[model samples]
Target: MDIDVFYGMCGENHKRLETIEHLFRDCEVSARIWAGLDLGIRVENAKSLNMTDWIIDWVRYLLSREGGVKRVIMFIAILWGLWIVRNKIKFEGLAMNSRVISGLLFESINEKVRTLSDQVDGENLKKCLKGGSGEHIEQKKSEIRDGHPLQMIGNQEQCNVIRVEVDAGWERTYAAAFRWVAYDGTGQECMRRQVRTRAESALQAEALGVRDVLLWAASGGFLHLDISSDCLQLINEIAGVDKEDHLIAGILEEMRGLSSYFHCLCFKFIPRHFNGVAHGLARQALKL
Candidate 1:
């Protein structure tokens, strides 16, 4: 049934049958390969020197004399071979190859993967990126409810301290496979908004990155997360612990209170050069 379900997704009957046969055949072949090696036989070259013909004959010689499932794969290649022959003879067509079948299967799942990519959370960071917070932050936004215009401007100051970059620079490639990855513990339903950016410093980019993640999380049941950044000066300014940097004091306070649902909130500082991948994302975030 599992094969039937996915097999139908392939669309071509001959392709479906071929892929199913190959999948089962490969699974069996791989499972028994080590045993063949231990027996000191070159299974791969069995096609040459008419070895498989004689081997099947020898296997038949054994089947009539003694037997097992090993006999099935060896002597009964005809079970699958027969169907392949019938489709060719009846429909005057060739069977589909494994590669083409895989392409169709993946193509069918690509859009769902994109939707899933948008819903995932918490940066499972790579070693090369720094400065930027998460690799794939929210990319688009939508209004989930009706609210007042006054609420529309709801204190950007009162919002949580989200460091964001302006563009979607080099970070998207790492995020390209995002459609398939899962968001941690959120059970798969996610709402993501696209981000817009201007060329800015890593700190500013990192700022935007944090903003997008939080903005997306706000829509779902997500409320708590300890955002890690490499900007120590910004965190101190945000917490009001570092007083004299008077520029964003109001901005800091507003973001600090943005979350009414979070159990706790935190912003941590990390090193710049060590934050390469995130930094790349931030740099890329600026381009988007």
Candidate 2:
């Protein structure tokens, strides 16, 4: 079936591909899959018998088949996520390993379980979140920054805020921000940008920030992200309760193009009082 993104590829027959063409793309997915495949190989020490050659041959075979099995795996996982289906594989429970990411991705977790659902209490298990039924997570409003404490998601602080200061300089416009860890989760990068003044408005600035991050991460490969800003007005606008002015339409247009690569991304707001560090960075960028 052709997706909208297929037709949208600007005459680039992105949707329809013969076996050879499709396999070429799956080779890219294999690049990602190989990271996980390595562990499976290492566990068995499949290094004997010119293993690399055999692996390459196997991949060529899968490609010849147009990656039919891999696509089915991805489709099934997406379905599990949509239906919230819980099941098991190899005697492993389904809660910890959802169809989306688990079972396929490698992790720091040790002592593989027969039941699979067995996990460290503090980490992701059945239902993705490591808690009883994930009800606690849903009730808390501290997931992002506000006047109260912010809960850290991943490496992010619960309510960390980003302050982007724009400079309307005589020569050129630029921006920057103060960098700090509101939640600062592991395997994550945290920083801020304070741009100089733009022809666009502040709401446009917020949209640009979102767009820029999405574009960068999809191209650069980020698994998780939590971006918070003190621009409540702009943040709300990006969340779509308010309409954007004409100034930012073009920038937003660019951002919508970046969607497939990210796994989790959330934008948040912190009160201005808590945004002193970002505010300082913006002020500093203007002076430069």
Which candidate leads in lDDT?
2
The CA-based lDDT of model 1 is what? 0.36
lDDT tens digits by residue: candidate 2, 200-246: 34455455555555544555455455555666655555445457557
Measured over all alpha carbons after superposition, the RMSD of each candidate to the real structure, in angstroms, is 23.6, 17.8
Q: Give lDDT per model, in order.
A: 0.36, 0.38
Q: Count the backbone clashes (under 3 Å) in each candidate.
A: 47, 27
lDDT of 1 by residue, 28-98 (tens): 33224323422223334333222223343343343333333234233234233333333443355434445
Q: Candidate 1: where is the Cα deviation over 4 Å?
A: 1-194, 198-208, 244-246
